[model samples]
Target: MTLYGLTAAPVARRLGAVRPARARPLLVGGDPWAVELARALRSAGLEVLMWAGSEEQRERIREAGLELAPGELLAAATGRGARLEGITAVLLLTDEDDFNALASTVLSRGAGIPVHRLGPRSGDHGVVAPYGGDDTLLAPGLTRLGVAHRHAQGAHIVTHRVDTTAGTLPDRHDLLLLVRPDGRLVPADGRAAPAPQPGDIAVMRPRC
Candidate 1:
């Protein structure tokens, strides 16, 4: 199976190439993926703060000479009502899927920060970072996760969401499969277009 690098149309449009302040990515995990992600983020000119998963991991992080963030400290720093002083984005690379999901939810809800995941392949609706040693791709800001599935003939199917209340509605097309809040897929085929509301998912196969 071929895994293509993720490209975001909405995120790129929102964050134009103006080059904002350097990013400070918070990486949580102690695995090689976390280390590699840190290196990649640094190479991208982003400041990194790493959190070790255990005592063994702590030694590794320290040996790597990265800023070590403890669990308690991170919780206090990113707790509810805490101000976002300088965090650009968050990467949850834990081995456990549950912790990763919880951390993503808490951080996103508490500080309005976007969290991405690196390990544990499929399951949650979190941002999945494709990571290789010293060669990872992590874009700035929130990236809603999506998937591509094979379709009949030479076409491919892609799906994404517009769940956030403040999210902009993408262009409407007849091939688009828009899911409503009540779990119904609304097709853009010949019917009155539904109003763009919260909790809508759009699926489409880009015509090449």
Candidate 2:
């Protein structure tokens, strides 16, 4: 699916290049947002361990066809008896603010994992630091969540000029460019921009 012209294809490609090869089990705190995040993570070939708080939540997770584990089991999974290894990240999706905050602290301190938290706000907000800690604050709506994810993933925002008379850009034309770590843009035609060191934004307009 496309979100603000950012599709999974480009997002996945850029993510693949930067993401570690080993699959990590994402520990999700139970909620609707967690459910959706689990789907997206699984689609990216990552394992998910759901820690739902109630039977109703468990049933909802089961209906979604995902694996479920008790919240208590999460501490164990991240501990000695862990069946999975190389946990790359953690997602805190619980509705309760206190619970999510506690989980974030534990995951970061105990497992040394990067944590993304969903909060009760109106727009997506995030804080990323050089010390390997980041927080993603999610609002009430789903669209904002996607925007938040892309922003967290460090995707560059691009606005293309669409000719109202002729229509949008051609399918082969690059409407949005996913910026790389070195500041280069990746497109289908193998064209690259001048190296864009960090903090540079690239803008291009289609020829009339």
Which parts of model 1 have CA positions greater than 4 angstroms off? Answer: 1-20, 74-84, 119-208
Give candidate 2 regions above 4 Å deviation: 1-21, 74-86, 120-134, 139-208
Scanning candidate 2 in windows of ten residues, the lowest lDDT window is 1-10
Candidate 2 similarity to native, TM-score: 0.46
TM-score, cand. 1: 0.44
Q: Which ten residues in a row have the lowest lDDT in candidate 1?
A: 1-10
In candidate 1, position 51 carries an lDDT of 67
| Whole-model alpha-carbon lDDT for candidate 1 | 0.45
What does candidate 1's lDDT look like per residue over 11-39, in tens digits? 22222223226656566776653564455
Q: lDDT, candidate 1, residue 14?
A: 22
Best by TM-score: 2
**Which residue pairs in model 2 clash with each other?**
none
The TM-scores of all predictions, comma-separated, are 0.44, 0.46
